[model samples]
Target: MESLSRAGQEMSLAALKQHDPYITSIADLTGQVALYTFCPKANQWEKTDIEGTLFVYRRSASPYHGFTIVNRLNMHNLVEPVNKDLEFQLHEPFLLYRNASCQYTVSGFMTRMTVTG
Candidate 1:
């Protein structure tokens, strides 16, 4: 009887842990500039140019899985928001240029495992 009770308690703990939120969220990424790197070929990592600013609007998170949907400034791809997983590593944060349009852009963040070599 005691063993069965312990098993139930463990399962409850596991469930609670699964419901935990990922560390990063949309609010944290909004208004920040980000870069995404993808390897067009094996052993080579390619990074996107700093074309615009990043605006994270919606995000889904859990202890082990999560993704963010973000909008970029000046990058009108017709594909509104981009999806980024939490596992991706966002690099250094810096500032961007503001032309006559009076726009403020951040440096940029990068995706995880963009390069293998």
Candidate 2:
């Protein structure tokens, strides 16, 4: 029984490593829009619109450690039709960088729109 349990644990760990070794905590942000205002100068506020498919993960060795966000352009880019079934794949190389506040980091390409009121 002990040997079987040990073998099962090793198999599970191996499967996890084979799935995704770098990225963790991924979320789908398809068709989501974010609205915010930025104060560039005194008594002035600029409205901004951001929309994309967000992919968040944590990678210790990554330059942008801690929490990172990725904007996946295509919804189906991360998945494919395999034998009539959908299979996930991590193929994109994200360009990581810290935000202005230095809190977290953001990666990949995202659409940014400036709203004029």
Candidate 3:
């Protein structure tokens, strides 16, 4: 587990872009957090018309240790089909494996690890 997390960090991967179209509609319930519409004119943070897809990011803890990738469930290598929910959950540190293409590195050593499927 620790090794997987370490590899993720060393790779320096992060949530890059959304798979949805830019013209799509956004809901107010989630607010500006999940998505942000890009404005080339202003170059500022604006509510995006499209929904946000999951991306890859490295999670780490010890400076001396390495990292691994909690990659997307549906998509291998997380190149496409970005989703935030996974089939399982980790109980060690209380983290949810959001589906399909997002890889998240935990921040610390988990006391336990749990998966739904």
Q: Per-residue lDDT for 1-117 in model 1, tens only?
A: 112255754553343334333322222222233544434465444435444323222224322222232334443321122223112223344323332333222235432112110
Candidate 2 differs from the real structure by a C-alpha RMSD in angstroms, to one decimal, of: 17.0
* Tens-digit per-residue lDDT, 1-117, candidate 2: 112255754553343334457533322222332222334465443323333433333333443222211223432222111122222222233233323443222233333322121
Candidate 3, residues 3-114, lDDT tens digits: the string is 2344543332322213222212111111011223234587654532333223222213212111122233333222222233334455544333333444332222233332
Every model's TM-score? 0.28, 0.27, 0.18
Residue 42's lDDT within candidate 1 is 55
Residue 10, model 1: lDDT of 56
Whole-model lDDT values for every prediction: 0.32, 0.31, 0.28
* Candidate with more favorable, higher TM-score: 1 or 3: 1
Candidate 3 regions exceeding 4 Å error are 1-33, 49-80, 83-117
What are the RMSDs of all candidates, in order? 16.2, 17.0, 17.0
User: Which model is ahead, 1 or 2, in terms of lDDT?
Assistant: 1
Candidate number achieving the greatest lDDT relative to the actual structure: 1
Clashes of 1: 3
